[model samples]
Target: MPMAADEIVSLIVAGIPDAQVEMTDLAGDNNHWAARVVSESFRGLPRLKQQRAVYAALGDKMGGVLHALQLTTAVPVQE
Candidate 1:
């Protein structure tokens, strides 16, 4: 079964405690999702590292349950 967007968001938030996650189904299918994650942990991290962190949160589900994820990670924008 395909992973739900909420499930993916929950996993990311669980791993990154203070993350703000917004998940959208880009193709209207659960398999293809776009996620915007804002976290303090991404403050100084490079883009690749930030993506890796999010992927790590999903563990081994990458190739199985979760098909593809379009992720954007950023530190919360300062006012």
Candidate 2:
């Protein structure tokens, strides 16, 4: 089964309380998704770690229910 876009956003936001998440369905099937997450918590972390946080948010769903995920993570600008 595929994951819903809102589910993805909710999980990521749950993981990163102050996160901004945007998701796109690459295949239009809701199975393949691309997520861009921006958070203050990611500020000093490595890119890989930032992405990992989003994945962690999804828990076991990452490779099972939601198989194809293209993730991009960034820290919010300090302005």
Using lDDT as the measure, which candidate wins?
Answer: 2
Model 1 lDDT tens row, 1-79? 8899888878988888998999999888678888999998998889999989998988888878888888888999889
TM-score of each: 0.92, 0.94
The C-alpha RMSD of each candidate to the native structure, in angstroms, is 0.9, 0.8
Query: Over the stretch 35-64, how does candidate 2's per-residue lDDT look in tens digits?
Result: 999999998899999988888988988889
Best by TM-score: 2
What lDDT does candidate 1 reach at residue 31? 82
Clashes of 2: 0
Off by over 4 Å in 1: none
Q: Please give the distance, in angstroms, between residue 38's alpha carbon in candidate 1 and its true position after superposition.
A: 0.6
Candidate 2 lDDT trough over 10 residues, lowest sum = 70-79
Assess the local accuracy of residue 11 in candidate 2 as a C-alpha lDDT between 0 and 100.
85
